[model samples]
Target chain A: MTTMKDIAKVLGLNESTVSRALNNHPYVRPETREKVMEAARRMNYRPNTLARSLATSRSYVVGLVISNIANLFFAEVTKGIEEVADAHGYSVILCDTGRNPAKELKYLDLLARRQVDGIIFMSGRLPAHVVAAIKQQSCPVVTISRDGTRHGIPTVRINNRAEAAKATRYLINLGHRRIGFISGQLDDAESGLPRLEGYRAALEESGIEFDPAIVQEGDFRMESGMRACARIMQAAPRPTAIFAANDEMAIGAMKTLSQLGFKVPADVAVIGFDDTAFATVVTPPLTTIAQPLRMLGTSAMEMLLKLMAGQRLAEIETVLECQLVVRASCGGTGL
Target chain B: MTTMKDIAKVLGLNESTVSRALNNHPYVRPETREKVMEAARRMNYRPNTLARSLATSRSYVVGLVISNIANLFFAEVTKGIEEVADAHGYSVILCDTGRNPAKELKYLDLLARRQVDGIIFMSGRLPAHVVAAIKQQSCPVVTISRDGTRHGIPTVRINNRAEAAKATRYLINLGHRRIGFISGQLDDAESGLPRLEGYRAALEESGIEFDPAIVQEGDFRMESGMRACARIMQAAPRPTAIFAANDEMAIGAMKTLSQLGFKVPADVAVIGFDDTAFATVVTPPLTTIAQPLRMLGTSAMEMLLKLMAGQRLAEIETVLECQLVVRASCGGTGL
Candidate 1:
């Protein structure tokens, strides 16, 4: 391993000069810095990251806590985060809790132990006590797609209630009065409650009577969505339109509808949220609310970076707007 | 901050006993350990990870080097890795290179400096010199979905050649004599060569003459697949079937085929590799070779753990089999 001393000796400069140049300290002369860099590159001198981290208390690494990576929506968000993290010379350590609170706690402990510079919590809702513990540890945390204001933590999220309402209102405008909703698991702490509220709010505004019988819960899985759609199909005066909380469920509902000889946007119109990659690939395409997944990810990372730098954020809750993409499923021209 | 001495004094036990109890060391008496744990819990004694790591020279964290997390196939593999790592009380530090070799090298250095117990390289075709450098660092490394034979490193992957050949043979059995191939980026060090070889081998065995004009290159992306399909369609006497290296490309090809008024299976049979989540959701569903994604992830982590333990593994390469999942696109029952 080549050290700073070796580079200094090779460049006929003091070790401190070489160190300053490597750190890009402004005091180092440009010409001398170039010579030092050339010598360091030639020697393949790699800095001692551990020693530097101990001295500076910055790991140049961020921790990302996610519920599951298999979900396309989260996957897209992760990509966005990765792009920004890389641009800032920060590596991301991902912890997937499988939506288990206990597992989430375990990962929190692990990240704390590693002394990561900052953390971005996505999808899974952390327990209040755990959040308190994280704050006590003095770790910078930015939550995404989950409310963090009560905990005094910064957050990035899409307006789930408004997006859901927009999708519902779109269906209502399409001359469909009897609309049904397929929700993610009601137990889901972050998304379930707000999305269902949005659906109800839209119905109330449209002067349409809300029917509890028309609502079904899914586990935010395609198979669960399929089963949930089956339950909705069995209800009397079946809805002429259905809105799924996310695209996966919407695709599943479409499959069930197609099997039952229902033509999308002809016999029924369907709308989904999150507009995952499959939303455009599915038959008849899908009219869905786009969540700006990549932007959500990148913004969360940037916010966490700011928090780590001891900077006051402009907003505690950064609410990104959602766009409704109309496609054939909602009786719109194909993209 | 409650130290071992404080806990020991409170529990009327030696500091070593308290440490052993907290670490769940087998030598501690069961009843005494239980008492110590109860006291420690009451005291809110959180173990100092940095101190523990310095004492043990092991942090219980593994490094995961992946080319990209946005790809569904890699995401599934990551989920599998996470399951095993979490179960074993290990956390994964993810390093995504986005297929950039320079970024991969930077991550390897960072992980080494962080003193990760081991590393799992997934889909990152690291250069020989870089792999050699990692080996010299004496950290255990296990490669997934790529061969690490040159560097004498442990690897876990599916038999790509055989799987591709099987997919092509299936198409031939479906009475498609003129088959087209959509190869993933030829520049990729992994998958490209083996898959192309498999395609050629299948054609030779079926006594069908291979046509260079029928093969198109894709970047394993949906848009790339669509473009490649369009080029293949423009070829004289278009192929009756197309085999894509992965599901995303296959779906893209299907989209283009549908737009051209070609009915899947009846007009052009399509097969894809890697049965991702969206494989079944697409309109003609995809027939794909299913890699044991979860198993691959789990095995890589296990191998890395063993390596970290200084165990000598005789077989460096672990090859898992791939299954052909027939779906509507290939004239089979939909999944």
Candidate 2:
């Protein structure tokens, strides 16, 4: 390890003086600071990277753009990203967009201004202009759980279609033919459309007709989920089980069900995606499709690192698998 | 709104070349980079703060040291801080300590290295060495929710004693005399001690003697709360109500109560602190002591900003109030 002490000794300066110079303290003469910077660079001191990055163009920092910081899903994902990032001598700046597209764009620009080496956008709405801006800067960007609409940008996400189909099949095998679906916004290309496709595919294969009447489009929020639950339950033929697109919506639906005097699994079985921490805590617990959220984050950060290193990509998109965690909300495995 | 183009015109250089010089590209002669830095300083361009900081020592970045970013409490608090920080032209790097004391120390050092203008540390177990290190740096740090054990540093937090007493008394007024208390780790100074005193004070005021058997030590986590509930329920004379130190523990206790064939309010009324989102979503909807969590963050950030701006403080500490949210879990007030 080439420490600052080595640089200081070589320049016949005190350690504090070398540190002050390297730190760009205003009190240090500009020429002295430049001399310390040059000597530190020659000594290959890692701490001098503050000045070294000027020549190397590496900040050794990455920005993680998350849709909602309050969501447990993002927290677990961040833990995974930090685990990998720490091992590589990088620190993460978590930029929470709070699910606002405009805020997302603003945070992206802010990160760019800060000169983060790369950015990993985790599960959020990305406007076209934001993509274009990212392209204009030629930034190293990777989209996680949400695909980047920008052509050829790498993405790390789960097989939403396959997973949704599997979750629906589990409900069907549990003797639920009248299954309702709580979907994300229809316009959400990454999760909504594909998840709906999988649900329909499973129903079609099971000889159960897909009924739009039982499908309620939720804005992927709790209140929306609660409203959708009420709508689906009042249909001409009520659903035996409800499959929610995400955990928040599912939890919300369950809350509404309980409020309406319906017992989970007995009166209305429910399942959700994401398998957030709340899934296990909610009454009866939730049986749902579990995305490998942590892995998704790690994979995205790894991809972004590769991009930052200018490594030739073998896979532009990496799709991981999802799991079906059985709990009391689905009324057990005995069909 | 100074632009690099203006600086380019002044120096008679190409736009990209001027950008390169300003960004300290090694290709540019050191003298040219210095000239561009000097010009950027003269023009007062905002983004040029990267180089400007070398002269003025202002990174315009604040670091938030949180115990657990995964918790909803921290998320809401961070939003408050960000709102204030953005208004002051500062960006925050949310450092999630993740409840690991060593990681907290590491992140503190990392923020120091990053040259953050100030830091706001939220509740967590702060090791003595870490506090000592923070004191040594002479950094502008304002403890939020957490208090500064290091002398004379500013702190902004809630009246834990007052709030906890109010929550306990609410349960008492609901005609519950044998109330169980779930407390945080005794050694954890920020939340544990003050909260316990309030609970005891409330019990004493009602002439209900405190029983050691009815009190359980929890680590302000859900698992501990669940276990504490079990232990409290198994007592010779089980309590009619339970007051948890934090929301996580309260929710955990409720889950356990349900599993043990007990009904909230009907069998065992429960109250919690922090009023997190879970307080509403949980079965029966927990009645809780609602801290002004957002204001706590904003207030601390504001104090930190004042400290960073070299402003004199009339009051070194600010204590906010808490509210009691009545919900289904506590039953009706007339009980």
Candidate 3:
């Protein structure tokens, strides 16, 4: 195994000089660094990163705990996080919890043991135990798409309430007096309740009565959306439009409407949230809320990097905006 | 910083015993391990895994270099890899290359520096420089979905040629004469050329003239599939059935057919490879070849694990089976 010492000997440079150049220290001259790197490559010198990290107390690795990777939303966000981490000479260790608390705890413990410099956490909901565990680990953490400020953690997210209301208002503008809403799981306070509340708020603002009978709860899954839409459509004077808290459910609702022999945007219009990859591919190209998914990831990672550097955060909560993307499902030009 | 020695002293146990308990050494009694764990939790002892790894010359970490995570196929495979790695007390460091050779080489170097136990590599095409770099790194490697046996590396893959021929034959059995084929990038010999050859072989077997005019090359992306489909459809004699090398391109072709006002099977039947999530969500859910994506990840990881353990492989290449999933796009019952 070739080492920095061997590279130094080959380059005829001092060991300390070779070490600084290998570590990319700014104090080293560019030409010196290049020569050292060339020698290291030629000698097949492999640096002992673990040892160096231990001595410096910095691993240059970050832990990313994502709820699920199969979900396109999280996948795209991960891409953004990876891009930023790579650009900054950092490696990311991804732990996909698959919404399992036990696995989440296990990964958190493992990451702490590995001594990752910081962590970026994304979950549908932050449980109390998990929050306590994170605090106990003493690792800098930045939450994405969830408001972690209440727990004294920095967060990057969009205003779910405002965006949900915007989507609702768009439906009301389409003259949908009897609009049905499929909400996310009630336990998801960061996204579900706010979205449902936004729907009610929109109805109130438009002088339309909020009928609890027309709303159903979905678990933020496509099948749940399908079931909720079926139930919502069974109400007397069925809804003229359906607004789902997420795109998966919206697409599900569209599928149900088709099965029920109703034409989209003619007999019933649908609007979804999250504008994921599924948004454009689904039939009629779903009208949805487009969140800057990648931006959310980059922002959270950036915040975590700053926190890891011991920099005081200027803001605890960084909220991005969400836009309503008009498409054929909502009887829009879909341009 | 609660050290193992401190925990051992407080628990009235030998430091070696405490270390063995914390490390899950097989020789340690279960009760002793439990007692040490309880004390470690009470004392908030975070183990320095880096130091232990260095002493043992083992990191208990593996590198997974995937082409893309946003591709549902790879994401599902990653889930499988993570599940198995987590179960075996191993950590996976995912490097999504996005098909860039420069990034691929950089990640390989980083993984080598990090001293990962092994690597599970997935790529559309493994270039010569990359193969040479892996050879130089002296790291155990197992490839997924690509044959690396020629380069003295173990591989886990499906028979792309056989599966592609099966899909073509299925279309032929459905009474299609003028069939169009969309291939992956020409340089991807493992997946693209074989599939194209399979299509050609099927045509020859069925006594149908293989017309080059109706075949087009796609980059295994949705937009490229659309472009290929448009070009294929413009052939003097429009094809009655179109087969894509992958699902994304297939869905793209579906969208193109819809835009051209052609009903799925009634006008031009469509078949795709890799029954990804999009296969089910698209309008007229796609008929595709199910490649056991998750199984691919698990198998590759298992092979890499065996190699890392210095175990001899019984087979150089592991080939899994592929099944033709008939769905609405192929005008089948879709059950």
Candidate 4:
């Protein structure tokens, strides 16, 4: 139970002086600070961070609301956030909501009640209630993957519509006329709906008719993708290529295609978004839309830090670019 | 801004009575508690959890020390930990060390100083300094994937050695000689070294001579596995089969095989440890030893909870089982 008082007594210094020295206050002499630190270490003094935080209103902790950590896309983003948080001497309280709005909101209120200095909202979609709560809370918030620009909240996200269109155009360029699309929650305004629109736009530009029967809904899960494949396989004039909203579904579609006696790129082709770790591991190294996830996480965290420091954001919606990674899955040469 | 006192004054009751009702104390009538909750919600009262925690010397927070969250195995384990912690109304402070010893130790010290109710050590290996720190800290520590039996620490882990031997024997039973083994750090007593021993044991039991040249090191990463695959290919006698320590490495090796113009199962049959998500995504889906990662995480958290509740562990080491998932990579029917 050694305390600042004990260090002060050991060094024959005033209690206030010891506290100032330990806190690295400018008023304390450097020599006095070193002496106090040495004494504190020798005594094995553990500071009461709770009390210190109460006094300074700085907990050195932040909240990170992530959609799903099991997904490699979010997992890599979390890694990036952690790297930055750790470097800044801050700990993160990760709340994985599994895409449940209720769970996400519950965590939001809980984090605010726990007095986190700031929060990083890393969910894919921004619901109205959550935006309202964020606006009401005194703490700063930075959104990742969703545009929170209209609400005056800073956001870091990639151009989903543009990237999705690029992916579709790439498939069209590869001589894919009858292409099927596996979408993730077509109702999702931020990502799914936009991606579907991109596919339709590409088809329109290529003078190819968009067939609703060939498009299936997948929840961005492998099983859903497999199920979607079944639907697409039964459609008239079966598609020669399939584009999934994400890599998991694409991999799942590949698995189903193989099970149904179809060889990838030989009989059919496939493409995926979010070039996650699974992209490279899959048989043909999937062609995908690569978003700089680590950068996304890093930038979001940095934005929150700046906001927490009482600085106004310079950018409202920080949009990052996505790259089209050509791989064997899309009949691209390994070379 | 609404306090219990305000509710008490408005209801013509004592503040203590209102507080007891809101807390759902046993002495408070159910009707009164319900009324108080309604009033609190109507008034939008937010509880000051910080003050209550300070008074009770409890933060309702636990520390989860994980090696790497980007690894799907760890991510699933984290999901399990979060599920259990949330059920108990506790938040997890995730400290992903990325297998860095210094970072791990720093987080350990930080968690201790932050006064986390308990800690779950989820690293592949527990260093001596960490063990020493765990012993010295007041907070209870539960370890996952390591044998903490000797140090009086409760542990939840699968039988790595037995599982490894089983996988090796399965390969041997398939009439494979000149088998290659890709391992994590051989010096890692917790997982790598034991798995290596298991491989040797299986080889000796099968009357197959153990050759050092066939074994290579992989740091549980895809790139490391790829590099090891290259080295194994250059061995005096190339291996007919390979067993990578984990699925990421196995997938990497598979990619290397394909790039080198070798087909899996046809040229070199392969198996992997930890049937991660990548196992099923890969072409010729990998056959692997599936560790109950979520159960391991759940059990570890439960063990720490018991220890925190002043209960002594009846068993120090809680060993879980591993299952053999046969897939296309090992030339096994999808059955």
Candidate 5:
């Protein structure tokens, strides 16, 4: 509770001198600063951070909006973001939108009002106009795991199309002539469109006709995938292999296939994206496309910090690669 | 950027009247309040949250100090906290200490500086003195998954000892006499001592002699379980059953034992605490104790909010029960 006045009275110096010393103003003598610091530490003095923030216009805090913390993918990415943010003396305010855009917008408003230095948007489908309004507030906003290039916001993401294509090609090379695709909800902004496009491109390149009947839309939930798989299986001459946009969906599909008396790989091979923790634990394991999730988070934080410091970012889009981890689910080996 | 002065000028009123009306003060006429609100909205006026915070001393934000988000148990618990916090119009700032008390202290300092209205400490070994120091700052601190009753801070946690005893008793009823125990990190505030105590209590009730050599310490990690399982396996008259404090350790032990050519339930039975997602997916499907993780999160937030509202809190502890989920891992019929 010690203020500048108390320090000044104790040191027999004017309040202005005490304030300058405490603020580390260059005008204050080094000797004065040393005496003031020693006295402050001795008295167990703590500065009024709220009052200081009002004057400095900096809270040294960043806002991170994620869909769900329980999702291992998001958790890993958050770890990456935390490391980068903490190293720079910045803390993150976490807002879980629960995949609700309205909630995401509400948090955005709250973060803006709180005057966060920057924001890292991870997952969730935030409306374009809402993002624009945030940018208009003059705070740096970096979008992660989603391509926000059209909005001109700095974005860090994986090459979803390329990774999807690679996964599809791998399936094709395994002698699967007919392939079914399970797509995530198109409204998810980052997950659905590019991956679906990649799936199409792979089929086109291989001289195979794109069959709309074989593709089912899923909301990225396990239940959605379960139902989608059931529908795909009921289709005439069901595809020999299935590619899900994410591991959760792929696992759901695998579970459904198992219940329906289909032997994975021997009957219908399965592959998933995101290489989440469940990717390895599911029966027959799972072959997955691994997004550099941690790197994506790290890059997002780094880019946001750079922008906050008034540095020009080299590119609006930062893309990392994905790896294909082949396991038993793709008709490979043990769990 | 429109301020009260701008609104006042447009409304032909004093800044004080505009401010009062905008704040919805009862003294202001309802008509005036409506006019002020309409003008503010039309002008896209956003209040300076930092300045308002300085005056009101309420940031409408809470701080969450967690050990790690990658742990599925913690992640689920966090999700519950988010649900309640968001509903109550409070944002949560997340600080992951990565199980380091020094880092936890640093984050506590940061949270204090940020002026979060309250804090929820989740599964971290924070010294009591640290909790006292935090409480001294006049911020409501609620420790979840850790005992903070003596520190006068509200706590929300499952009855770990009772849950552990139940899990052990279940194994005992299954005709297993020789059971090995894997203890979580001793430093981990919750889950360690209480779980071990519960394990011992169950053995005592069954009139079984406590075997110190059969107990192994694990850091609540899968790799640690693997090492501990190896050590236990080499013991004279190896245990026919193993109980891990958590699912990760249980799965690790199962994987190691299986690799060593032991058939689960037939050669060695395993049970884990915290029925995480992996518990069901792993081969032999782990039978474990299930904590109401999400409810714990919600209750913690509610308690913190109540404390922040100046309500006199009743006894600072809120203990929930845990359920024992039977699965193939515990030598139970999958049916």
Candidate 6:
């Protein structure tokens, strides 16, 4: 690592003179500054950002705590966050929790110790201890999940309940009376419960009975979706339509349906949420609720940047819209 | 944000004494250390790792420069890296380049400025300037891509040529004589060209004539795959099977084949590489070569750790095995 001292030695100047020249301080002559810059560039001397951050009180790094790395949806969000952060001259510390509480807390503590400028919490639910940890940090924290705004933290997300209701209503309009629902972790008030409530509300509006037996719980994973589909299939008279909270589970349900010799949209229709890349690649091309995944990430990062700059947030929660992406899986024309 | 001075004030002790006690200096009494620890905890004071790193010369951070974040294959690799890094008490700085040369260079400089302890370069091909940048860095760098080892940098990856040959052989054994090949970025010596060479080698070994007309170049993206597949299909008599450099392309090829009214494994069998999650979820599934994506990440990180610890690597390049995962897409039984 080339340092100011190394440049000074090469130029036969005082280290402080080299530092002033590099920082473009008025005390240093322009010719000397030019000479110092040339030498620094030739020696590949990178400014020590970590040490400089101590004086500036700005690390220019944001910690993104994602719940799972395997879930492809987060990948899009991460992309959006990286683009915004990079344009702002910020680097991201990716802390994948993989839904482990211990790992999540450890990463939060690590970020605190490292003194990151801010954090973007992108997880399903915010635990109390995690909230406490965020509160303890003097740095601003913005969340790209559903529940964070409840704690008064700036949040960026879509209205899961309304989007889910739209999906259910779309299915209802397609003339499906009995619809099986695959709910995410039911305890996740920000994610699962609200979506479930939306499904129920849509059913009530359509004058269709909401049957608990036809609804199965999934962990928002493919395997859980497969298992839930199997369970839902066992319900007497089997629902003609299924709406999964997310695309992964919906694909899992479709896989199970395929194995059972059922044709999608003919024997059983399927709908999914979060129109991730998988939605388009699936056999029938899944009809899903397309949440502004990348926008959510960019919006959260922008809000965090504002908060970090000590600016007041015009809106505490930025709720992006979700659109129904109609495809073959739901027996609908592309929409 | 609590500082040692705050803890000292709370405990009615000198700040220097509190610092020494917190550091557990041998000169400090055990009782005084305990009192300082309790006070620090009560005040929620976190020892600034940035300042501590300046003294220790260890950032406890590793920079992972990925070419693309949207590629699901890298997600598994990141998960593996994160798990190992977390266990080693190191944080990961995720630098996504999005395949832009300027962005890649910028991130490399950022990692250098931040003084990351080491770096894991994950990209298709290592450009000459990137190699130069790595060489100039004081910290160790291990690449998880193909060509980094050519510059004598430690690398961890599957032998692209050999793995592609295996995929080609699998298809050959299934009685496909006219096999169309969809290559990745052809200039990527570490990724694209080697895989293309492998396909040629497999054809030669099987005494099957390699026809140039059926081979099309792709950029390793789904759109490229679709375009390449369409081009390849324009060949006279149409190749009976297609082998894509990666799964995304393979899925795209399948999509194109379906649009052309061709039945997979019946009209035109399709195989892919890097059996990603999409391989299984796609209709009819996909038969492809499965690289130990996660293990590659773990291996590169572990090797970088060794290099950072000043240990000599027994092997300059660690080559993992790639297996053929046979499924419905190729009309083949499980391997």
Which lDDT values do the candidates have, in the order given?
0.84, 0.82, 0.89, 0.87, 0.85, 0.89
Candidate 5 lDDT over A1-335, as tens digits, reads 56778888999999888888888899988999999988888876767666777788887888898888888888889888988999998888888888788877777888877788899887565476666666776589998876577778889988888999999988988877789999998775577988999999999999988888889999777778888999999888889999999988898898789789998889999999998788876667789999887888899999999999999998988988999999987775322
Q: Compared with the true structure, what per-residue lDDT tens digits does model 1 show for residues A63-115?
A: 88898897777888999998888788787788887788876777777777667
Kindly report the docking quality category of candidate 3: medium
lDDT for residue A58 in candidate 4, whole number 0-100: 83
Q: Which stretches of candidate 1 lie over 4 Å from their true place?
A: A1-45, A55-60, A126-132, A187-189, A211-213, A231-238, A333-335, B2-42, B128-136, B187-189, B233-238, B333-335
Check candidate 4 and list the clashing pairs: none
Off-target runs (Cα >4 Å) in candidate 3 are A5-18, A24-39, A333-335, B8-17, B21-39, B333-335
Local accuracy of candidate 2 as per-residue lDDT tens digits, B237-308: 889999999998999999999999999989999899998778877778888989898898889989988999
Q: Assess every candidate by TM-score.
A: 0.87, 0.87, 0.94, 0.91, 0.90, 0.92
Standalone chain B TM-score for every prediction: 0.93, 0.85, 0.92, 0.93, 0.91, 0.92
The residue-by-residue lDDT of candidate 4 on B1-335, one tens digit each, is 56778888877788889879977789988887888888888878777666667678898899999988887888989988888888898889989998888888888899988878999988756667878988887889988877677787788888788999999998998889789999988888888888888888999998999988889998888999999998898887789999998888888899899889998999999999998788888888899999887788788889888988899888887899999999989896432
DockQ of each: 0.50, 0.33, 0.71, 0.61, 0.60, 0.74
Q: Candidate 6 — what's its lDDT? A: 0.89
CAPRI verdict on model 5?
Answer: medium
TM-score between model 5 and native:
0.90
Residue B82 Cα positional deviation in candidate 3, in Å, after optimal superposition: 1.0
Q: Write the per-residue lDDT of candidate 3 for residues B1-335, one digit (tens) a residue.
A: 78899999998999999999987899998998999999999998988888888788789889989888877888989988887887788888889899888888988989988988888888646778888877777669888877587888789999999999999999999989999999998788899899999999999999999998999999998999999999999998899999999999999999999999999989999999999888888878899999998899888888888888899999989999998998889896432
Best by TM-score: 3
lDDT of residue A308 for candidate 2: 88
Alpha-carbon shift of residue A139 in model 3 (angstroms):
1.5
Candidate 5, residue A301: how far the Cα is off, in Å: 1.4
**Model 6: per-residue Cα lDDT at residue A213:** 93
